[model samples]
Target: MYKIYNTILDFSDYLKYDFLSLSDKPVTQTPTSISIQFHQKPESNFVWIDSRDYPGLFASGYSNDPTELWKCLNDAILSYFGVPRYEAKKRGLPYSLPLPNGQAIVQQDAQKYAGA
Candidate 1:
């Protein structure tokens, strides 16, 4: 299995390629051995792998170890494309793989009313 982070949507075209052409199913279908191809829908920022009909393997992100997931996916992409890790680092090819992170603001109380 191979994983590609697809930060700047560079590998978006590959997503349309047949990843399971050679084999009926992925050689290995574990969290660490599954392949990932991330691509955003038109006019969208989220990339999703719809494993609805897929059997054998899938890709998922970990909430606790987001950094590791990014690193691993980037590495896999570089390797699959036969690009040197150092060159990619120097060129900043990975672009920007955004993690599902954000903050929620809450209003504890409304403005205090004047003393009555």
Candidate 2:
């Protein structure tokens, strides 16, 4: 499934963007920090990846493995920023674990999760 089933990110309701109108965007810029916005479903794990100061992106995934969800979030963010997957392995998508009840369960580790 490539890990995409559901997702979300915090964004202002008033702002707008023309993502389809993208041009001259960096094909591969230095990767940025990211995080997983996670919520628990009755029988599954849910994760959301997005940034408040950036685009109104909301990429989500459902699974039992948190690592898989984190990888999903990482890919979404990388693609959104025009950062290639190969670059993620190098520069890495530095981020923390899923947030359940607005708290992180694991310490941030880009080294272990990058290109994971």
Candidate 3:
């Protein structure tokens, strides 16, 4: 059976690391105000959790199988660094991150997630 879960990031951590984000429309507010409301989307490309529990602190992923769940989470992180899931699995690496002077190369596939 699948269960709901959450992931969180510290404000300081978010500030220090580069991540991906998407924008959301604000709730009711005055038109004259300069401030606007924004919600942080999942930095991961594979999954995103939109919850109201903790504002920007609480995020979640849902899956019945633990392995699949972790894979999705890992995939999301890897995609952020422009790595595909297949490459990470082949190299036996949790995920791939670009090095300052090194590049991670992945061949284009006709179908994504198709096993060799």
Candidate 4:
């Protein structure tokens, strides 16, 4: 099955909360491969390919590995803050595509979270 981490509010805010609350005992297992696309975004950024399926969204600081996840989360935070020439550029925003290895996935620019 496919899982999606929809950012209900500001991506930064959600990420921040997740980091602070769940960082201690982060979900170590990899999440099922899914397409995560940010609201009001042009394209899907990241592709998470794991076997486990995460049912909810994760906060920024929350991670199984505080150190490693922190690095990635920090980079994501920086990119969201619009830091010029940041390593995690716009294309690095938290977005995913849900599809099997042999299947094709297409990105939609329309409003998918309008009424949700």
Per-model TM values vs. the true structure: 0.31, 0.46, 0.26, 0.21
Ranking by lDDT: 2, 1, 4, 3
The lDDT of each candidate is: 0.37, 0.50, 0.32, 0.33
Across residues 3-95, which tens digit of lDDT does each residue of candidate 3 receive? 222113333333333233322323222112111122334553333332243233222343223344334434544443454333343333242
Q: Of models 1 and 4, which has the larger lDDT? A: 1
Per-residue lDDT value at 15 in model 4: 64
Runs with alpha carbons beyond 4 Å of true place in candidate 4: 1-64, 86-116
After best superposition, candidate 2 residue 81: deviation in angstroms?
Answer: 1.0
Candidate 1 residue-wise lDDT, 1-116, digit = tens:
13355433434433422342332332322232233345445664434432233342223344455444455554454454455432344333242344445431111111211112
- What tens-digit string does per-residue lDDT give for candidate 2 at 24-93? 4454753345533444556556545556656665566665465666656666666677764334444454
Top candidate, metric lDDT? 2
Query: Could you give me the TM-score of model 1 versus the true structure?
Result: 0.31
* Rank by TM-score (best first): 2, 1, 3, 4
lDDT of 4 by residue, 1-116 (tens): 12233343345544644445433433232222333322221244333222223334332322223333323433443443444331232223333332333443232221331222
Off by over 4 Å in 1: 1-61, 98-116
- Judge candidate 2 at residue 88 and give its lDDT: 49
lDDT measured at residue 49 in model 4 versus the true structure, 0 to 100 = 27
Give the residue spans of candidate 3 off by over 4 A: 1-63, 84-86, 93-116
Alpha-carbon error at 63 in model 2, in Å? 5.7
